[model samples]
Target: MNDALEIDDLTLWLGMLEKVVDGSTNMVVVTDRERRIKWVNATYSRVTGWSLPECIGKRPRELLHGPQTSAEELSRLASLIRQGQSVSNFELVNHKKSGEPYHVALNIEPIRDAHGEVCAYLSIQSDITERRQQERHTVELKQRLEVAQRLARLGRIDTEVETGRPRWSSEVFRILGMVPDEAPREFEGLLAFTVPEDVSDLRRSLADGVEAGEELDVEFRVIGRHGQQRWVRCRGVPACEDGRYTLPRSWSVQDITFYKMRLEEKRQRNEELNQLVLARTRKLEESNRALEEFSCALSHDLRSPLRHVAGFAHLIKENLAKGSVDDCLGFCDRIVQAAGRMQNLIEGLLSFSRMGREGLNVERVDLDAMLREVVVGLHDDAGLRNIQWRIAPDLPAIQGDAVLLREVWINLLDNALKYTGHRDISEVEIGWHPHPDGPVFFVRDNGIGFDPEHAQKLFGMFQRLHSEPQFKGDGIGLALVRRIVESHGGRIWATSKLNQGATFYFLLPNIADSAMPSDWGAVESVHAIGCRCGDSQAVEPGLQS
Candidate 1:
C-alpha cells in the first residue's frame, strides 16, 4: 500500500509542475539528453508561433536560430550544454515560426537523475527586444548631446553642495584646458582658474546664488591651464526637492572671447567716429570766425587805403587851385604812395584767398634745397645787413606740396628779416629733429618779438600783431603760412616774449607715415599734437632752441 501511495504522489507532483510552467509569463522548454525538444509549455508556443507537437522532435536551435543570430554565441551555448553546465542570461537573436527576428535573454539549467548523469535540459527565456532598443536609443541620444556641446563651445557642471563633490563633463574639461580626470572635486577649487581681477566677483556671485537658492548669471574671465586668457559666460540654478534647495547645482558655460573682441572693436570705432565729428565741428567754428574777420578787414582796412587816396587827391586839387606848384607836387607824391599801398593790400588778399581754394600736389620736397633757393631770392631785400642763415645740415625731405611749402619758407624768413631790422647782426636758424610720431621743424630768429599772449591770434586771416607803420605788411603772410601747413597734414605754432627772440615750430609726418586724405576741405585728417603756445612744458627738449 505504501508503494501505491508513492506513485500517486509523484503523478500529482508532475501535474502541478506542468501547470505552473504553462501559467508562467516566461517561455519554458524541456529537452532530452540528445538536445531534442521533449516538451514545451504554452508560453513557448505562443512566443515562437510553434506548437508543442511540431517542436517535439526538433532541437531548439534548429527551430529558433535565424540568419541574424550570432554563430559564435550559439557555438558557446552548445559547448556549455555538452559539458552539462548551466548558463544564465545568454542573449542572442532568435526567429519565430513566421520568420520575424526578436531579441531573447535565455537561462538554461541541466536536469540530472538519481545516478548523477544529465537526463534533460530546461530553458527559460524573456523577450527583451523593446528594452534593448530603448537602451540603444538612450546611448545614441547621449552621443548627440555631447557632439552638440562640443560644436557650441559649451560645457556643463554639476556640484553637490552637501558633499562638496563636483561632476564635470568632457566638454567642461576641454574648456578649462584640462583633462577629464583633473576636474576639481569642490566648486570652490574652480576659482583658481579665474583671473585675479575677476575672481572676487565670480566668487561673490556663486556664494550669493547658492545661499539664496537663486539663478546665477555672470560673465568673467578665466586663465586656463595653458595660460590663455578667455572670456566665458556662465549661467546656473540650484536643484530643488520638496520645495527646498537640494544638493546638486547645475551650470552651463560657454566661451565668449571672440564675441568680446568684436564688441571692443566696435566700441573703438564708435569713439573714433565721435572724435572726427567734434574735430569737424571745431574746424567749422574756426572757418566762421575767419569769415567774420575777413569781412571786417575788407570794410575797415581796405577802406582806410581808399580814404587816404581820396583825401590826398583832394589836397592836390586844392593846392593846384591855389596855384602852389611845389605843394601840389608834394600832394601828388603822397597820392602815388597811397595807390602803391592799396595795390599791395589787394595782392596780399588775392594770395590769401588762393591758399584756401587750391588743392595740394603732394610730393617729396627737399627743405634744404628749398631753403637755399628762398635765401637766394631774398638777397636784394636783405641788402647789406649782416644776416646769418644757420640752416641745419641734416634737414629732412618731407611729403608735401612743393609750391605751398616754398611759400611757407619765404613768409617765415621774410618776417624774420623784417623784424630784425633794428638789430646790428641778425641770426636765423632753421633746423629739425626726429620725433616718434613725425619730424619736428623749427625756425628760430633773433628778432624783436611780440607779446606771448597774442601767439594764438597770429594765425587768423589778416591778423597782424604789429601795425602797418611798425612792420611793412598787409597782415596776411602768417595766415597763409598756417593754411599751407595745415593742408599738408602738419601743424604750426609760435612762441615769443616782448623784445626777446621768437621761435616758430611745425611738425610734418614722414613719407612712410603720411596718410593724407583725398578730401582736404574739412582739414580733419591732420593729427592733432598739443598746440598750446608759450607752454614750455609742452615743448620737447629736442624741439627747444
Candidate 2:
C-alpha cells in the first residue's frame, strides 16, 4: 500500500512538470544521446507545425533547417553536442511548415546520467525574427545617411545651448582637416580654423544670429590644418523643444570654392567687355566728328563749282544775244571746266564711301614684292624724270587685304611723284621703323611739303595747304589712305615743314602682334632732311631707307 501511494505521488509530479514545460511560450524538445528527437512539447508542435509522432526519432535540424540556416553554425552545434557541451542562445535560421524562414535564439543543455556522462539533450528556442529585422533596417539607414553626406560635401555642427558644447559629424571633422578624436567640444573652438581676415566678422555674425534665435546664413574662408584655403557656405536655424528654445542652432556647411571661382571669372570678363564697349563708342564719336567736317567741306566745294557754272552760263547767254562769238567761246570754256571739277569731286566722294562698306579679305602679303610691282606700274609716270627709289631690303610681310594695301602704296607714291615735279631729281624712300604694336612704315619724299602747322589738315578730305593749280589733286587721296589703314586696326599720320620734304607714316598691326597701340591716332612729328635724287651728293643719310 505504501509503494502504491509513493507511485501515485511520483506520477502526479511528472504530470505537473510536463504541464509547466508545455505551457511555456518557448518551443521545447528532448533528444537522445544520438541527437534523434525522443520527445517534444505541445508548444513545439504549435510553433513548428509538426506533431510529436512525426518528430519522434528525427533530428531537429532535419525538421527545421532550410536554405537560410548557416551550414557552419549547424556544424558547430553538432560538434558541441558530440563533445557533450552546453550552448546557450545560439541564434540561427529555421523554416516553418509553410517554407517561410524565421530567426530563433536557441538554448541547448546536455542531460547527464549519475556518472556525469551525457545521455540526452534539451533545447528551447525563442522566435527573434522581428528584432533581427529591426537591427538590419537601422544599419541600412546609417549607410544611406553616410553616402548622402559624402556626395553633397555636406557636414553638420550642433550646439547644446545650456552646456555650450558642440557635436560634429564625421564629415565635419574631415572638412576641418581634423581627426575624429580632435573634434571640438566648445562651439567657439571651431573658429580656430577660420581664416584670420574673416574670423572676426564671421564670429560676430554667428553670435548675433544665435542671440536672436534666428536663422543663420553666411559664406566665409577657412585655412585647413594642411594650410589649404577653402571657401565654405554655412546655413542653420535655431532648434526648439517643448515650444521653447533648447538647442541654440545647428549648421549645415558645404564647400563652395569652385562656385566662387566661377563667379569671380565671370565678373572679370564683364569688366573687360565693358571697357571694349566704351572704346568702340569713343571711336564712333570720332568718326562722327570727321563726317561733320566732311559735310561742311562738301557743301562749300559743291556750291562754289555750281555758282561758277551758273555765272559763266549767264555770261555766255548775254554774249550770245550780242552775237559776239569770241566772248561766248571763252564763257563756254569756263562753264565746261567748272562742270568737269564737279564731276571729279562727286566720283571721289563715291569712291571714299565705298571703302567703308567693303569687307577685308585678309591674307599674308609680301610687301617687298608688292612695292616692286607698284614701282614697275608707275614707271611710265616717271618718264624722262630723274627719280630714285630707295626701298628697305628688310620690309617684313604682313597680314592685310592685298588689294586695299596696294591702293595705300599707290596713293602715297603718286603724291610723292606729283609734289616733287619741280625738283630736278625726285628722291623717295620707303622703309619701316620697329614699333611695339607692329612696324611703322614711312614714305619720305624730297618734294615740296606743306607747313608743319597745317599737318593735321593733311588727312582731311578736300583740305589742301597748296593751291589746286600748283599740285593738281582732289585732296581726297590722303583721306582715303587713312580710312584703309584704320580699317586694319592701324594708325597713320604725316609730318613736314614748308619747302621741305614730307614723311607719311602708317602702322599695320602684325598678325602675330595684332593688339593695337594704346596711343593710336596720335600724330608724330618727324623732321625732314633734303637731297636731290640725281645730285652727285648722295641723298641725306637720315632720309635714306
Give the per-residue lDDT digits (tens) of candidate 2, residues 1-545. Answer: 22323433433533554677988888888787788887778888888899988998898888999999999999998888777778899999999877889899989988665556666677888888899999999889977886788677777777656766677766666777878763445434555778999988988887787667788788888888788887888887766676654334577778777788999999999999999999889878866866785696678888878999999988888888998878888888888998998898888787677675678999988887999899878867678988988776646678999998998999999999999899999888886655656777878888888887887898888878888788887778888898889989988877776667787888887645432223332212121222232222222223334
Candidate 1 stretches with Cα past 4 Å from truth are 1-18, 159-166, 182-184, 239-248, 268-364, 380-401, 417-452, 468-472, 486-491, 495-503, 507-545
Query: Candidate 2: where are CA atoms >4 Å away?
Result: 1-58, 111-122, 155-253, 257-347, 372-379, 382-394, 417-429, 445-454, 461-471, 498-501, 511-545
| Model 1: per-residue Cα lDDT over 65-122, one tens digit each | 9999999999998898888888999999999999999899989988766566776677
Error of 2 at 387 (Å): 5.6
Global lDDT of each candidate: 0.77, 0.77
What TM-score should be assigned to candidate 1? 0.73
TM-score (all chains, Cα) for each model:
0.73, 0.69
